[model samples]
Target: MAKFISFAISILFFVSTASAAPKSDLWERWDLSNEASDVQVSHAQWSIFLSKYAAYVDPATNTRLVDYSAVSHKDHRVLKAYISMLTDIDPLSLNKAEQFAYWVNLYNAATVDLILDNYPVKSITKLGGFFSFGPWNEEIVEVSGEAITLNDIEHRILRPIWKDKRIHYAVNCASIGCPNLYVEAFQSSKLESQLESATRTFINSDKAVQFINGKLILSEIYNWYAVDFGDEKSLIQHLLNYYEGPLYQQLQSYSGEIEYQYDWKLNEKK
Candidate 1:
């Protein structure tokens, strides 16, 4: 009886440990070594697809609304082919900037493919597993022999490896709360300016910052990932860097708590 009880305890311990372990730590393990600078990455296909399907609601806001309903059979095929091509390319063989731009485009294209696969749905969270909020956990793509998910692309690959807060603007969540999905594909040649533009556009947008009831309101992104932007003071300084006009001047003298909110509605065209 004593031996049997010991065996049961060992089994219980194993079960608990296994349950606590995350299935993947791809982000923690990613490291890019300097490689050949001339490796070819064709963003033309992705650019063409985006121009045809994505539309800006208002140029002033830079808000993009995807026309998921208008995706033709050919366009869907093209995007799938592009994603497949990405999986075959080794990031280790490309320069760091190229790899960075590659992952961003691949992630965005894959997300659009997933949403197009289940179009007409009210929200991306509605698709895939009935018990989950969205397909963030599902291993939906393969990259250089490793299976990856949307969560892996964002949290693991981009956020952890790049360690850039501006990355938040680059990876779209297919929801209104997310930064506007850029209609142009990211390219290594233009990465710096692209990242800067994305960050500035999002920081200045009403979706990210708003003044309400004599208080400051910010996107839940700033609240949820506060650590990424450092402390509250750091966040305000970061915003000031991009903001100009009256908003910048107003923040210069304001010291108060930031209220946070997010909209999860699918950013689809009407």
Candidate 2:
């Protein structure tokens, strides 16, 4: 099954690129014809996030990684079309408040595609080399008419300005601890609801915290961003807010073994 899947990926990669021919580019450097799905990102606000945030992995050493430039032409056309919608729509045209949220969502989603592009076989940590910070690259995105790094976005904009610790949960780095990447583009109207849903979904998922054998195995994200999840509140409280159904109740008074682990593997075509 694995071999066939990989083979199919290979065929799709080449076939899609055959008809490439177009002109004019957003962010200027990247083109759509040869690399259409790259139309994956838009919005001038998101420009900063893509320009500043997102860790870039070196494709040379990362043999097991998925060459996004290759396969982006295929897989999930609706999602790609939505991204194109972003490009076609004038972000400046949106209201100031709406524009900010639009950029944030675009940046986060585009980053997901960037990681999936190199979506590697080993842990995401493995993708980063000696000089690399993590398996991500801030360079994959284009923003503010300049290419920026991921560190800039996280430390500078998202964390500081938004001041909402829960945001850490909203932007999935395609890591296990992160909220699962939303299948579609995050629209401005849905920002607040999206963040709330993303927080709830990620915390409750098996990847973050799970109720198994009367124990609570948690994700490292909780530990790393414990303060963001309201370090003021006990870990139990944090979990309760983000989880619902039985899990919420189970965590109320439940004390069990605490386990934390993360998966860096790309959330590829399942």
Candidate 3:
């Protein structure tokens, strides 16, 4: 009986870990957009909030951390208001660039708002009840009369619609292992440049790639959303696109096994 129980526990653990990385499935409703429309959604409130709270802790790694403990009650309300404003906007009315910026900013702003609401926690994975891994699956907002979760915004809308690998860098999970949350809100006019910058910043950082003991260590993001990055060879090619200097040469020469690691600690300011 004891042996069987242990076996069953191991199987359960495998199932849970396998299912933790949500697949990139389309939600359909968010697929709608106006390519010709010039409608713009304002992210000024989110920008202001980021400016006040977000800071670079390590210049070498470009790790941007948020001051959750320092957020005043008034600023918290402002952050909430920013999310509310995003929820109220009709995403279908905007052009492709605007829509891209909208979803990325919304995902990021909502994530920050969630952390602030549940501040003092060691990690984001601690919230959303016992059966939950994190708040990603929780219905945190409503858009176009349908409830939305962080998972939906990312997997359903952003990934399916944009099909840009850089989307991973733009949508933060409020964790140290995740890509750095930009200190500024994404704007439509600067969306391409922002995405490019984010991709470059993360790819070059140790969080994305590291060479340890002559082996390749990559962020778990690559493994979780492997489809977005393609096979191992393709992934290396992708990395090479952003890597630079000695690291770039090392990546080109290395042909060993790839290992993945992630840190789920809250990316809070010290």
Candidate 4:
């Protein structure tokens, strides 16, 4: 009887531990392992909803409260879903290391989406006004069982663990000046690819920068995060690697822009 009782207790312990263990990730929704080519995903969903951005936006209010009942990127419904998924789910519910990665990436991605929800504005900073204002400070963007602020996710988690500089590109601030808004959601598996692509895409655009007198005029981003790109004297060298063209030599010779002109206007969906 004693032996039987001991065996039963052991079995119960094993079962409990198994049940409590984090879930195995059977699926990675997004994959961009192939670094040879730039990855592109569908924007049809976002485009469809954004087509009506002009109709729903209220200029006087300078507020963007569109129909996000659905999970449409353009409609901004995905923002709410992302927040819901992040806040309600348990962290330990996922496997240990994966849990942290998932948390940080989700925090970064969802924050961008939520900020964009109050979209149709000229600038993300506008959301915050002087002397005390702005929704960004609201804090506690609930997501995946986590109640965290943008500062928490950015400074605390992402900065500490991930040393990669491309994170700057992945986390959009939602102004015309910010990196181009990605349509689909960001998953861990696709993190590297998304970051690379965002960096290349943004730096290549005319809004943030322009090619002047054969010189590579860069956005303030390069200036602000010059050290982040790579340890090089010239900030322009970092961008040239991604930009492969006849102008490569030209960029090296001339990476300095006379000045930068970032569009404070909201990336309106007109």
Using TM-score as the measure, the top candidate is 3
lDDT: worst 10-residue window of model 3: 55-64
Residues 35-106, model 2: lDDT tens digits: 122222334433332333222432322111223333434442433444545545544445534544555665
Worst 10-residue lDDT window, candidate 2 = 30-39
Evaluate residue 164 in candidate 2 and report its C-alpha lDDT on the 0 to 100 scale.
Answer: 71
Error of 4 at 135 (Å): 4.2
| lDDT assessment of candidate 1 | 0.81
After superposition, the stretches of candidate 4 with alpha carbons farther than 4 Å from their true spots are: 1-78, 90-120, 132-135, 143-147, 230-234, 255-258
Positional deviation of residue 129's Cα in model 3 after best superposition, in angstroms? 1.5
State the local distance difference test value for candidate 2: 0.51
Estimate the TM-score of every prediction.
Answer: 0.87, 0.59, 0.93, 0.60
Per-residue lDDT for 1-270 in model 4, tens only? 999999889878754543231211212222112334233332233334434432253343222323323334534665455455556655434443344345544554554465556544555555643422233444656544345655555545554445466656655454556565553445445566766776776665664446776655556665555555554444566667576555566666662434655544554544
Q: Between the candidate structures 2 and 3, which one is better when assessed by lDDT?
A: 3
Model 3 off-target regions past 4 Å?
1-15, 59-61
Model 1 worst lDDT window (10 residues) = 17-26
**Per-residue lDDT of 93-204 in model 3, one digit per residue for the tens?**
8888998899889899989888989888999988886667888889999988999998999999999888999999999999988899987999999988998899998998
The Cα error of candidate 3 at residue 6, in Å, is 8.8
| Each model's backbone clash number | 0, 16, 0, 11
User: What alpha-carbon RMSD in Å does predicted model 1 have with respect to the real structure?
Assistant: 6.4
